[model samples]
Target: MAEALNAPTETANAHAESFLRDACATLDRLRAMRPAFQRPSAGKRIRTAFDLADECLGISVEKEALLLRQALADRQNLAAATSAALLRLAGLEMGYRRTRGYPAVAQSGDWLQNEQFVARNSDLKKWAESALYMSAAPANWTGRIAQALFGLAAGAAMAFAVAAAILANRWFPAESIPWAILIVISYILKDRIKEWLRGGFLRILPKMISDRMRDLIDPKTGRWVGRTREWVEFPAPSAVPAWASPLAAGEFNALRREIPPDDVARYQKDIRIQAARLRRAHSRMNSITEILRLSLDAWRERMDDPCERLRFVEEGRVCEEIANRVYPIGLALRFSEKRQGGRHLIRRGTLFVTRDRIARIVIEPTPEGGIAGGGAAR
Candidate 1:
């Protein structure tokens, strides 16, 4: 009875230790390859990393188990070291996933184009409105009015001076002086003396507004809300500024053309495979952790009371089943058969190991139908 109780606890510990050793070795291998991985460009480095991850996924369970057994037989206490290495690798992979910026090829081209157009038009409208307002009327109406009034007062004062000059001297011609005064009065009321200054101020105002609007626009989508650009004078395509050539020019055209249909298909397939492998790894890690926890609990229970051997053995069997069960290649499977080309027969099904030592497949029912298991059948 004592041997029977101890057997399961010992087996669980050995298995956990073996798995951790193998994981640590894998992490070391990845670390060794880091320099070579970093040699590639950003995009290429991501592709290489995915390829390495795929290779890791392809490693057979039998080989990993054999390696772990050998390492354990050598009597190496590497559990803590292996666990630390595994955690480091996981952290690195997670950081890479977070920071890697792939081109938005999978996104809808029409949507992106629409957003770009909307943004461009919005900016154009704002510029047009600014230009029109600046050209049509002064922005500082009060200042303009004040200046006009000042000019009128000056003109009136000059007129009075000219009349006084005429009255005080016979040399000053009254007819010519009256004509010149009339011209000065007309110029002051029209505010034509300050026309050049207003024009300069208006140009600067539109530019400042344009700079602000450009800052607000999204760099990727170029979309902005409000206003229309029907009247805005957009620059000719050929006259694109050097600074804006990357954005305003057809820069994406070459990139788009470079990515053929076959490459796109291949990329999508690779992404799916990588995603599946990553999810599988994550699930396997969780299962391993649960197995260890269950094993430790059973061990502790056995230590507390010798009579609980049977219960501990039973719990150990459950942990062994969980550890030994092969996780499904794809975590989730969706039914392909559709009703009236609308709803699927089965919504989706996930593969999970039940506590009762059974691989239970739970499927969600489609709105149009009850529960079904046709995903694998299809």
Candidate 2:
């Protein structure tokens, strides 16, 4: 009996060691491929990450085998080893995806397979539980509260408008205008008016919110830093100028004739400034065009029914598509806070989604004394 127990114990230990060794080797291979895997295309990077995930699943199967052996041996060491291996694998997967510019929400679904593996192996259950708890934590309570308040205010405004419309028909207009007609007109006009107000508010809201935030003074120099808002509008693709389009070259040439030869440098500088603005505008337009194209593709795939698709187009859901695109790709907002060696900070209430999409905005300091946005994938 003693010899039989010792034999199984030795076998379990060997299996555990082998499983760990293979897991590490797989991770090493992934790291080795990272350098050559650098690609400009987001789709290609996502595919590569998926391939890495498949390899991870293979490793997990081997881990499961070791877990079974450990259970047979009745050793606590097996659970510890399994937890460490899973955590390490998860860390590597997250790091690899992030480095490749994959959004957290996009990669989040891939973890479901890992979760299933954990479910089969009791050792990893604690890690899964902890992850759930951490994810559920109310880290962005301020954002949540602000969103709730905005919803409530919008509801209240609509209610008041309806009530006022009914009262006007009753008290002032009397029998001239029917209460039903008045209410219907008010409802229709209210949406149009709200759209107009929202457009104007959005134009200035960012600056207003930034002003209310704590001034970001340079930690080293204590100098006041000014905030600059960079607005890049993405109109329809047709609005964008052609790649080789002339940038007021004819006008510039005409102006050159009026300027003295000594002032040619200043004239050229003005032309350069205008040309740069045109280029920036074209770039933003192209980006938005691509984003809309992708979003439309996603929408079409989601709306399979012919009637549903037609309804989407007829209802002018392009605005919703634009919102979805912006939620994921995010709008760029550069600030001068980083110029003076201070961290970039935005007031929590300022960032918001235009539509009902579950997106969280993340701002990271860039190397060029600006901030970059990382929004959750819708």
The number of clashing residue pairs in each candidate reads 0, 0
Residue 93 accuracy (lDDT) in model 1 = 41
Per-residue accuracy of model 2 over 80-129 as CA lDDT, tens digit each: 55545645655665555456553331234678755654544443334333
Compared with the true structure, the alpha-carbon lDDT of candidate 2 equals 0.43
Candidate 1, residues 1-378: lDDT per residue as tens digits?
Answer: 122223454553455555656765765676566666666565785756554453333233323444444444345433554435434545444344335431211124688755754564455445433412211111244445555655665566556656555553464455677656665565464454345445555555443332111112212233321221111234454453332232213765667446752110000000001224333434442221101011224323423222222223564473222233322211222233323443323233444432233256655443344344434221
Candidate 1 error regions (>4 Å): 1-7, 40-378
Candidate lDDT scores, in order, read 0.39, 0.43
Error of 1 at 110 (Å): 30
Clashing pairs in 2: none
